[model samples]
Target: MFATRRADLVLILVALIWGSSYLSAKTATAALPVLAVLFARYAISALACGALIGLRRRPRRWTRDEVRSGSVLGITQAVVLAVETYGVAHTSAANAGLIISLTIVLTPLLDRREGRRLPPAFFVAAGLCVLAVGLLTSSTGLHAPRLGDALMLAAAVIRAGHVALVGRLTVGRPVNPLHLTTVQTVVGTALFLPLATPHLPELAHSSATTWYQLVYLALFCSVFAFLAQTWAVQGTSASRASLLLGTEPIWAVAIGISLGGERLTVWTTLGAALMIAGTYWGQAVERAHRTSTPMEESLRSCRTARADGAARRPGAVVASSPARSSSRSRGDTT
Candidate 1:
């Protein structure tokens, strides 16, 4: 129980850290180019993750398949982040936060296509998600959507793909999550460095405040949050992890409004609320299925045991009866 609580706490921390990530990224991007912000974020994160890998005693060598899987996952992850960073830069942190919650709905659907069927509640949650999106989109009178919102929506889709791929590739495999994170961070850094080349000199001229924001994004948001999430998920159920981590958008909204000077209208607030509720419900449904499965199995096992005992009762009664005893005695005399 203590361990479980610790894991839950860690996951919540991860959510908070991630929730603040949007604001930090937004702040950094305000001063630096998007690619430059991403470059610095990934570069620092890669070093941090590498240092973590070195701390493992008797570290196992990466298999050929692990390398291949990591490379593929890394590239996919890079795209997800690239789009997400750009989206946040162009949109309000609040919008980015709320819109990205689409991943929760998208992931199960993606998994369903991969041969896993979800419960009916999942569809209800999806419907709610759609409604929420409509509410958010119409906050500005249902005109053309902001480019940033569109990019974030796209990022959510790609992020869902990334999640689905991670599940598919890592299952029944010897690939380590730490190794995967390290590889992806390195890949992201390499991919963004060239794009950030023109702005590389801008880093030297940036304010201390901007540099601090970049550091926060790199360390807490990327490295620590990833490590915490991986560790927490290993110790908890997937549904629980989703439920806990899903709080990220709430934090994002909070930080955006309070710290980032972003405004929130009633329509936007309602949309954000709906999005959060839908995501939570979606995860809750899955968690319900996971929790009930073992109980159902145990109940079936008990019923089978009872039926077998009943089937043996007639034989036991016959052997003990007087008629059966007399018949046995006659056979012995013959």
Candidate 2:
């Protein structure tokens, strides 16, 4: 029980860290070019990851699959971050956070490994999310979405694809999460070096507060959040972990309002509530859909069979075979 509580707390903490990252990134980008900020964050993360790996009691060599998967994921992850950073630079942190939560629903749609069709209700929930986005992006009036909000929407889509790719590339493979993360940070550092070269001098002369934000983004948001989440999730169910982590947008809003002096108009307030409701509703629907039992599957099949037979004959009945009791397990990672 104590362990569970501790894990829950840790998960929430990780959520808080991630939630605050938009503001941190926004602050850092204000002081430096977006590319420079990205480069520094990745470089700092790479150094931290390297130091952590070196401090391990027994070092293990990276597996072939780990390196290959990490390289691919690293590039994709960089693209996601680059877009996300640029998005936040042009938008409010609260908006960025809220917009990015669209990933929660988008990921399941992108990743169809189970080959099970989500119930129609899931689509309704998704539609609610789309409505929420509309409200959020057009809080002032019914104009086009701000460039930042549109970029954030794009980031959410790309991040969903990246998450799906992570599942596809890492599932059933023996990949060390730490090693993979280290490789990813290293790869990101390499990818951004050339792009940020010209801005290196400006980045170096950034104020202490800007450097603090950069460090916070790299160390707390990336490394610490990832490690803590991985540890906490190991001590709890994926659903529980996801529930705790899903509070990220709430924290983002609270922090933005309290710390960043961001305001929410009536429309945006309604949009925030709708976004939260839509995401939780969608998450529950997806979880239930994913965890459907053998009996449920059998019943679905039986219904389809009955419909097909009914189409063929005036009155036809189709019976489902007895379902075998089978256990299904779910896993999650950051």
Candidate 3:
């Protein structure tokens, strides 16, 4: 239990690291094509990680099911990065940052349709409204990423599906998050490489700054951030995991304001605030729903059954009062 809390904290911190990638990616794309930049980022991270694994020589073996599951997970992440990279290249850094963060809202809807507990619908509606505001604030001067925005929206759906699938598939199973994450990086890179081929010549002229950006995305964002995210999600709730991740745009906004010299007008600020507020409320509702799950009700039910058994024991009769026991089981959702 104590360990889980610490892991959750690490997960939130990892989100911060991955969130800061916006600035790094935005800067790298100035001289590199989007696909090439992401290809370099994942390729570097995979090579480094593979070397570390080789050094440890850990015999990390998996069953066929694990490979299949991990591959599916990888494909989802790959699609998301591809779409998000394209979106970032075409849109303002702020808009890409905020729009990707909107995955928090999309995740629950996926979960609900898959038989996971659903949170309040208001939050979902509000999130779409906030996304519209983001579009408005970020679009202008023939610079609007109509295509890029569509791609980012696709990324959002892909990410949400990944979260939902992880939650449903890994329940009561022994799935290594690190292995799964590494596989996804491999898959994402595999998809990007073909697209990146045309830009290979550009790499020869790239400077040290580009390498630095690649290293950050590769090591911090790709490997460690993924390992941390996977570990945290197993112990934490999806909305809560995503809620902690909800801090991402905040980090992006900070990076933009400080390094990019970007300023937020009143509308952008208010829209972002509205988006954050809605997600928080959604998380609160989701937590309430989880705690009130049938599992908890079954716990109370088992307690009643135990007492009934005790009454049948020699001279051991519990009182027949029903009020207190009823109260114990009467959760809001129950």
By TM-score, who's the top model here? 2
TM-score of candidate 2 relative to the true fold = 0.89
Compose the digit string of candidate 1's lDDT tens values, residues 247-329.
Answer: 89999999898998988778777888889999888878766765676688889999777767877886542223588789999
Following a full C-alpha superposition, what root-mean-square deviation does model 2 have from the true structure? 9.7
**lDDT scores in order:** 0.85, 0.92, 0.72
Candidate 1: worst-modelled 10 consecutive residues by lDDT: 313-322
Q: Alpha carbon lDDT of residue 253, candidate 3?
A: 75
How many clashes in each structure? Answer: 0, 0, 0
lDDT of 2 at 308: 85
Alpha carbon deviation, residue 190, candidate 3 (Å)? 2.5
lDDT of 2: 0.92
Clashing pairs in 2: none
For residues 1-334, what per-residue lDDT tens digits would candidate 2 score against the true structure? 9999999999999999999999999888888999999999999999999999999999998899999999999999999999999999999999999999999999999999888788888889888888888888876776789999999999999999999999999999999999999999999999999999999999989999999999999999999999999999999999999999999999999999999999998878888899999999999999977877566888999988777877788676554344421222222221
Q: Which candidate is the best by lDDT?
A: 2
